[model samples]
Target: MEQLIIQLISGAVGGNAAGSAMKNLSLGTLGNTIAGLVGGAGGGQLIALLGSGAALAGGGGDIMGMVTQAAGGAGGGAILTAIVGMIKSKMSS
Candidate 1:
């Protein structure tokens, strides 16, 4: 639950950053946020699964672990948002 919240917040930030960086792919604040939230949650979960399966699998009970999780979530969110934005842009054109 806590991790989910962290991912969602990070995802929102990531989405906004991506949007600001690429005007052509910007989906507006609300659209970017929503897409980011979903992407973040999914990405966080995926990372957690992979992380748990790896040798580095040490529960996210530590600061570094938490940071890694947030970074993964944010990165995933940004990528997803950019992909979606590009698709939308292409479709509209």
Candidate 2:
């Protein structure tokens, strides 16, 4: 229960960051918030699953832990968006 809430908040933060970092994504405020939530929670789940219990219960769902992971994921996502945006720009012309 606590874990879920933390994860949600983490995701929201990450998605919000991602939106801000991305100039071309234009998900809007509400969309960005939703995206952040999804990204944060998804990243947390993925990390836990890939870590194979190593990340589980070990600050895995904690506020700081989730925020850090979410930030990383959001940054990665922003980078990905930049790459995609560049590719699109180049291809469009």
Candidate 3:
């Protein structure tokens, strides 16, 4: 239960950061928050699959592992948002 909350929060932060960073693509506050949550959760799941012996070993995934994955996703989302912003700026100008 606690772990779930953590992942959800991480995702919200990342998405918000990314959304705000992007120029015209800004998802507004609500949009950003939702994006972050989804991205983080998705990232965490992806990480678990990759880390567990090609996604076959850990039949029972770890909570800590998922948390870390969510963090990575949040970070990635921020970076991606920045990149998108840059591209948009270049195109606009």
Question: What is candidate 3's TM-score against the reference?
Answer: 0.58
Q: What is the C-alpha lDDT of each candidate?
A: 0.80, 0.54, 0.59
Measured by lDDT, the strongest candidate is: 1
The local distance difference test score of model 1 is 0.80
Sort by TM-score, best first: what order?
A: 1, 3, 2
- Please identify which of the two predictions, 1 or 2, would achieve the higher lDDT against the true structure: 1
The candidate, 1 or 3, that scores higher on TM-score is 1
Q: Candidate 1, residues 1-93: lDDT per residue as tens digits? A: 667777899888888888989999999999899888988887777888886322223443666667766886798789889999999999999
Q: What local lDDT score does residue 20 receive in model 1, on the 0 to 100 scale?
A: 89
Q: Tens digits of per-residue lDDT for model 2 on 30-58?
A: 76666566555665556556663234347
Q: Which residue pairs does candidate 3 place in steric collision?
A: 11-36, 11-37, 15-36
lDDT of 1 at 30: 96
User: Mind giving the per-residue lDDT tens digits that candidate 3 earns over 1-93?
Assistant: 443455567767887777765647665677567666666656555654566322222433665555565576676455544554556567889
**How far off is model 3, as Cα RMSD?**
4.8
What number of clashing residue pairs does each candidate have, in the order they appear?
0, 3, 3
